[model samples]
Structures are given as C-alpha cells and as structure tokens.
Target: MLLLLIFGIVLLPKASTLKCYECSSDASGSCKDTEKQCPSNGYQCAALRVTSYAGASKVSDINVKSCAVAEQCVEGSLNFGVSRTVITSKCCTSDLCNTQLAPAPAKSTPNGKKCFRCDGQTCSGTLNCEGSEDRCMTTTVDVAGEKITMKGCASKVMCVGSETAQLPGGIGVGLSCCQGDFCNSAISTRAGLLLRVAPLVTWVMFS
Candidate 1:
C-alpha cells in the first residue's frame, strides 16, 4: 500500500502536464511551429493575435502562442483615434490545444457610447464606443522617463480582470476605467495617478 501511494503521487503530476506551441512574431507575420512543455503553474494554452491600425490603414499584426495563465485569455480592443490596437486570444486546457492560430480581430461598428480621446497633445476629441466597449479607459505609462497618456473606449474584459492588474509597472503606471460618458477625461498628475486610480478602479468594477 505504501509503494502504491507513492506511485500514485508521482503519476498525478505528470497527468496534469500540458504541451503547448510557443512562438511570437511581429514583422515576420507568422509564429513558428515550436512545441514546449507548459510550466506547472500554467493552466492553459493560449493563441493570441494583435492587430494595429493607423487611421483606416492596417499597420502591423503580431501573433503569439504559448502557455498562459488563465487570466490572460481575455479578448479585447482599444481604439485611440490615431492608432487602434485589438487583441484576440483563445485558450484551451488540452495539450497542444493552441496549435490553431488566433483569428484576426474584426472591426466594430459604432455603438453610440462616446468618450474623450487623445490626438497628439490634445485630449478633447470624442470617440464612439463599439461592440463590447462599454467602458471608458485612461492609461498612463512612463516610457523611457517620458510620461505617455492615452484615453479611449475599452471592453469590460480589459477594465476588470487579472490582465489589467498584471500590466507592466509595479507602481509607475495608472489605469482607470469608468462607465459614464467622458468620465475618463480628468486624470491626476503622474505622481498621484497610480495611487489614486487603482482604488477607484474597484469602484468602477462594482458600479
């Protein structure tokens, strides 16, 4: 019985192991077909595609597939006038489930919800929210010592999820989401933005 118990314990870990495809590409335009074993902490295999648009012209597309945390499987879009980024991610638990490539995100039609957006140094323009984008979002990130801010419409998955909490930046970035029209118009200074905004995001999630 003791030998059998030890054998079962050893087999249990192997039973939970998953194999996933792992590759990333931007300019190459395709992900290489490479297989990898998922780490013990990884719960799912994911395929992701990111499409970038400048005005009405498509600029670039990125594809990635790998072992992913369950929380990173959310699919969403963010439109910021001059540039728009859309991400589509599919997740599965079975081994090699991410072998299929994620499809390109489709463009969405206007849905009547409006929010403030930025254009260069100006943040007074309005953006029409589309599809599942029912929330207004403001993101401030420090890039190479320069503060960059963007405001736009965002999907609910982008606002309230483990994905947002895991965004790059220990405490230097500020991200806020609100439901009302143009509610993301005003943001605090860089020094206090992250501190003040993180708590406010919880209220937005519940409201």
Candidate 2:
C-alpha cells in the first residue's frame, strides 16, 4: 500500500507542460512576445484578435497571444448599428504554437434578421443582424458603479457559457438571448449612447 501511494504521488504532475506565447497588446496590429509556461493543465496556445468599428469605418484592432482554455477558443461578434466589435481566435495544442496573430473576422452582410438596439434613451431602434448573427442579445453590465445596458445582434457562439467572460470589463452582466426577429425587447436606460460607442479596451476584452 505504501509503495502504491508513493507511485501515485510521483505521477501526479504532467510528463510535459505546455508553453505558449504571451502578449497582451491593445495596439491595432500584430504583436509578438516571448514564450512562457502555461499557467496550468488543460491549456492551449491561442492567438486572438478583436476589432471595433464605428459604422463602416474601422476604429481599433487589438491582439493577444497566450494560454487559453478550450472554452476561449471560440469566435463571436456584437453589432450595434453605430458600433460593433468582432472577436476572432486561433488555437493550437502544441508548445509555442501561437506564433502568428489571429486573422481578422470575415466581412458579413446583413442576414435579414432584425433586433432592437439602444442608442439614446429608448432601446427601440432596430438593427440588422449580420452573418451568423442569428440571435438577439441584450446585456447589462455595471461600469463605474453605474448599470449600463446595451442591446444588439450577436452570434450564438457568444451566448455559450463563460466564452465571453472577458468582454465589457468582465463584470457580472445580466444577459438574455433569443431567436427570431425582434425577440429581444428594449430596456430603457440612460447609458444607451455610452454603451453604443464605448471603446473595446475600456471594456478590457483581454486579460
């Protein structure tokens, strides 16, 4: 029994650890950084990019390379008429595999789906849902002690559990998702415009 216990303890650690590139940049381009050991087991090397747009003009683009869990390997987007944020990622299981930055999200046209979005006081404005944006979402997050709510179109991937935990400051967000046109109703708020044009970095999309 004593020999069995010792053998089990000796084999507790992994035979080989995973290493990945670590770069957290808010700059609007590719970034490269030195490799580092993954924080823990069950991690993958990941390269992620997030881009923000004001109407049709691009506003900012950010990139990150680091260790990520399987759940963080997804891609999603949030589109409000006046503003939008698209997240794209590439993940690999080997060491130092996150060398290249993630590519930009593809251009998607309106998919004929419609959802309500907030711009000013009332959240009654209609927004055209785009490519893969088959779901309507409404999110309320606390920022600077004030509760801010924003409604718009989103992909189903963004509604999955814990996948979007890093966006919009990572604070607890009251989120609701549904399918069909105008399924997400408007919630009146004072921070409508504040959220419509909020910067992506200010939301801390990457840790």
Candidate 3:
C-alpha cells in the first residue's frame, strides 16, 4: 500500500500555469491589480511599453501587461520618416512577476549612420540613424484597404532573423530588412508585392 501511494504521487502532473496581470491600452494608463492564470504555453509574465512619436513630439503611448511567449520579449525601435515607434519589454518567469511597469525607452542621439527615407511621393531624403541602429529597413503595411510604405534605419535586433520577426500591426503587414547606406532607396511595385505576399498569405490561411 505504501509503494502504491508513492507511485501515484509521482505520476501526478506538476503545475505549469502562471498567473499574470493582463491589460492593454493606447494611453499611458494604470494596469489592474487582478491576476489571471496564464495558458499552458504562456510561461512568462511580460510588461511592455510602446511609444509613438511624430517629428520630435510623442503622439501616443501603449502600456500592456500579460502572459507572453519567449519570443515576445524583444526590444527595438522603428523610424519611418514622420513617425517613429519604440518598444520596451520586461519579462519574468515567476508567477505575477510583472507587477511593476517596464522601464521607459532610453533617448538616443544620431550615430552618423544614414539611410534613405520615404516622404510623400519621393524617396530622395536621408535619415540619420541613432544609437544601435545600424541596419536599413523597409516596411509595407496593408490594413483596412490602405497600403502604406515606410523606409528608414533600424537597429540590428529589428533586422532580419532577429526576435522582432513581425511588427505589432494587426494584419497584412510585411517587413524587410537589409544593410548598407541607402539600401532601401528603391520601392518598386513588384518588390512591395513580394515583401507583402507571404504575410498576406499567412493571414489569409489563419483568418
């Protein structure tokens, strides 16, 4: 009887669920204190802050706390001419570990790297890359029947094969990264189609 009880105890599964706070808002608002159990695959608690800027002024900020996958713990920024978006994420493995807010994004100065950027109908202007931004990037997003293209400098982490595989846009978003100065200068229709096709296909299959 004692042996049977010990075997039964060993056979029981260990608890894998994590409890984390969950909230998302476009404005810089407070997160609720309530904690909820995370899904089985969600093994980490994450707190994130995303700030958007137009020119030199901040336009919007988003704050979120929730269960996350390991891939979601990336930190990077994207500059697209008139607008820029920066993301900062903090992650912990323990339950309810994201009780505090993530740290704000650090300010960066120009680092002498330059890349071509799109402005209206022209792509003749150059943008000075800042901080760890050593790569050039081009992004094409097709959301709600509107096609928008953005090209500028990007950090190494935000480039190809890094943690930030896809951006935060909802659907039909495509991103391509490359190196060299003014690498993203040309944005042909065929190139745009190629960049956006795979993501659009994935979205179609999933949705």
Best candidate (score: lDDT):
2
> Clashing residue pairs, candidate 2?
none
Question: How much does candidate 3 score in TM-score?
Answer: 0.76
Across 1-207, the per-residue lDDT of candidate 1 in tens digits comes to 999999999888867889888887746686687888876756688887767666777776777788877766667766655566676788899989888878888768998989987653467678898777888888775545767676778877666443645422221125478898899874433332322221212111100
TM per candidate comes to: 0.78, 0.82, 0.76
- Which of candidates 1 and 3 is the stronger one according to lDDT? 1
What is the TM-score ranking, best to worst? 2, 1, 3
Candidate 3, lDDT over the whole model: 0.66
**How would the candidate models be sorted by lDDT, starting from the highest?**
2, 1, 3
Model 1 misplaced stretches (Cα beyond 4 Å): 160-164, 167-173, 186-207
> Which ranges in model 3 have alpha carbons more than 4 Å from their true place?
1-14, 26-28, 143-146, 166-173, 187-207
* Candidate 2 Cα deviation (angstroms), residue 16: 1.9
- Whole-model lDDT, model 2: 0.76
Q: Give the 10-residue window scoring lowest on summed lDDT in candidate 2.
A: 166-175
